[model samples]
Target: MRPARGSPDTRSGVRWGMRLTLNIDASPLRRWHLLLIERLETISGLDLSISLPETDLPDQSGLGPLFRVEGLLHNLRSDGLFARASRAEVTVATDRPMDESDLVLDLGDGRASVPGRRWTLHVDGDAGEGALVAALLAGRMPLVELKEGGALIAAGRPGTEYGRILLATLDDVLSRVVTLIVSAVSGGRLRVPTLPPTEAEQAAAVPQAGIAQTVVKAGFSKAIELVYRSCFHAPHWRVGWRRLDGPDLFALKRHPDSGWTDLPDDGTRFYADPFPILHEGKLTLFVEDFVHATGKGIISAVEFGPDGPLGAPEPVFEQPGHLSYPFVFARDGEVWMIPESCSAGRVDLFRATAFPGGWVKEATLIEGVTASDATLVERDGLWWLFATVRDGGGSFSDALHLWSAPDFRGPWTAHPRNPVLIDIASARPAGQMVIRDGELLRPVQDCRQGYGKALGIARVTRLDGEGFAQEVETIIEAGGPLWPGRRLHSLNSAGGFEFIDGSAMVRRNPLARRKPAAVLASS
Candidate 1:
């Protein structure tokens, strides 16, 4: 079939300094085409010409060799037996020889051409509405190749979340295509790195069917518990501390048998996110005091002695929206805080105008991001900010993004690879990072079962402009008699004391028992 006429040149500011052609089937112009075109347009120096099967032919015989894309639009209409057979045909066609410079991106579901020569990819969906959604979500595409004998070559497991999986797969496909085209034109082999499986995929191998079944069977019990708790029990958090002699924060486990001394509360409110700081040879613990009536949290602090807290936690800072995760640190001879204010859609900085009582807004480090637990660290002459931001829609504890700046106050630039880490096991920052023996150790929330079900330690392997990486070293669960709860989330330390908080059950007050009626009393 004669190729159709070329579309208007949308090429603006070419990136790769080469001309390329994409010959896609005219009948199946799809959403994937638009995505591919949009991404390619971002690259400068490369002049792109999208040619359909009905477009007029150009005299390419004299151009030595041309970079081309083909065989991405078949099986769009066929289905059942015919569709399967057509897929097989498309796979076979991918192995055909072309100009060494010609790059073929085969996304069909069949045998793939040899790797290192031709690029092939596969998206796990049928060619219809499902396929369209998959194409749209694909931010990076995964590479797939079939050997001469139909052996598949790929890394990592498939993701459970369809949106994340599709986006990553599509992103990989486009990235690989760009690498191939750029290398072919520049006479340099730019190899695309092997991508790890998405967080959903890495976590999918664990079976949750039995757990889900149990939850369903216990629905009545859970409903009754919920009703009772709502009517009587309010969430109350207390701070537990262990004396640290020489920065062996992990030694807090040794006193597992010692019971926790509850930080006093008025029963109308609860306290959490305990962060202790030492100033002028005195220890002051900061917490998120959440009032049940107001349904909002405010920053509060209390003095701690060698035995326990000196008095009640007094309010230090309060904002219009809900505030939690009072991540405080001492820098430049002043106290600073970066609390989680996701409700306000910004992460703001607060400086103590008066120690432990008065705090004023210093600056808004990051705006327009629904960030939680904005932890800051000064490393290698740069300030690094770690937070889990909710982008679009998903769990807030799964994706970790990083930003670095020369100064803490202004001009923060996001890491080149934002959302650098995406594992529910250790993505959310539970508390401030501690440096031990010149090594950075971060406290992460293990949300595999639920938010803050447990606490984990991740040792930083790499953190720079290129990327961010970490390995979970230790996991601390809520157990061992001292702290009895199903959730253990925050961890912090100051002076000779380390603080932790967790969940606890609250029962109905016995003092509020009803009195006998007036007639019975008189009798």
Candidate 2:
């Protein structure tokens, strides 16, 4: 049916809806610039066009020669590099004249006069080239901002590993740009959160580590890892437990003064992702039992007696793919679990027919998404699911997404604004969310140093149909008197006992170097 005279038509929005022009420098462009243009074209009610304005960018501190040699070496040795998406190549584009538009996305260095509204992009307050690279060389990702006539409209801190600085950081920054533009076109309120630390305060500029230095560092790191693996079952994790007689982590916002007791584990396998739940007046602790031999993980549970865990965690649920982060909770007189199964590309819900065992697949809450650590909570008569998604191509620990449902099981709907939070320090769920003094406190993974290097407790100030926001109040790291490890991964509490997990080193006996008799295959 044709629309009325004045009604908006999404099919023909190019004629009636807003027109957006992306202004770029006359010099060569990067792969991510084209990626941003491709994404804008997919929106329904907006028309996108390219503009090449005569401009020049600041020098990139001699990065052109450095990246050429670094990228080639990285491509040749595939195993040691950080998880990355694309190689940012400076390629040429055909010149095109600017079309009349309602909005201009100025990606150039200068803030020239434009036809309509102009939002200029800035990195760490510098609207010049090499800003991102300069920040990375100084040892951190840059804070990206969008400004209109020097007024801040939106800002975000883009994160990535230092090895693939150019490609990974660009991927995340462009991802945020899409979110900003889409919200504007859809009449949604723009999120103008407080800007993070300034570039000067964050770090001082340092020269890029030359190719020789990087090669030496990589070789030394690789050799140490090989030796560690040969001498021990490396990357082994262990859980810690203590009676919760005083304030919990949410209220305390720090590790308890009294040290935690270690949860015993056999040498064959290690346990992590501690989740303690109470059902029908019984307390049980569940973990991700990862067998070193099989190289797979399964959900396991153990009953807690008056003193401590009755025994080691026994396999309660097994799948064909790896699983972790067993987020078990009680609802509607039943116990349910949603484990991290991103390898399967879906989030599945399971109900416990028998208290801690006999878990059966109940429903698939979400599909076709590689979401990590799916955490579900009920608030204001609605169930909200939080997880970090690998949107487009970037780190899985940076882009957070949300879904809402009437119940915990079916008919889950994605939030209108996804990638609601794009911060590597506090995007991934570390454990369950808790309530303290009429406020919501969530445990999050701080992956700034490395994956699961520390834990952060954030206060959720705003969470509704409109959007989500949080303030990280505390960061708890490992290697203290209580917890001695390199990575503090997860935290949870129930039935008067609190639980946490971190990396532990377990040596393998050199005399018994042979493989185990039977490998526990996943079902």
lDDT of 1 by residue, 1-523 (tens): 3222332222331223334443343123334344445455455454454433333323221211100100111111212111112221221122233342234333333242323333333333231222322333332222222211243332111111222222222332333333233323332221212323433334443422332332343344446656867655445555667776554435333234545555655556677899988887889999999876688899999999987788888999997889899988888999888889997888898899899868889899998888889999999899999998665444566657799999888689987555665555577898878777788889887665456666777788788886666766667776557666666778888777777877655444443234311110000
Model 2: lDDT equals 0.71
lDDT value, residue 395 of candidate 2: 68
lDDT of 2 by residue, 30-148 (tens): 44566566666666656566665344334334444444444454443321212222323222233433446677778777555677678787777877545655665555655667778
Please report how far candidate 1 places residue 511 from its true position, in Å.
6.1
Runs in model 2 lying further than 4 Å from the true structure: 1-16, 53-96, 111-115, 161-234, 508-523
Show how many residue pairs clash in every candidate, following the order shown: 33, 0
Q: Model 1 misses residue 33 by how many Å?
A: 14
Question: What TM-score would every model get versus the actual structure?
Answer: 0.62, 0.83
Best by lDDT: 2
Q: Which regions of candidate 1 fall more than 4 Å away from where they truly are?
A: 1-225, 231-235, 250-259, 508-523
Deviation (Å) of 451 in candidate 1: 0.5
Q: What is the C-alpha lDDT of each candidate?
A: 0.56, 0.71
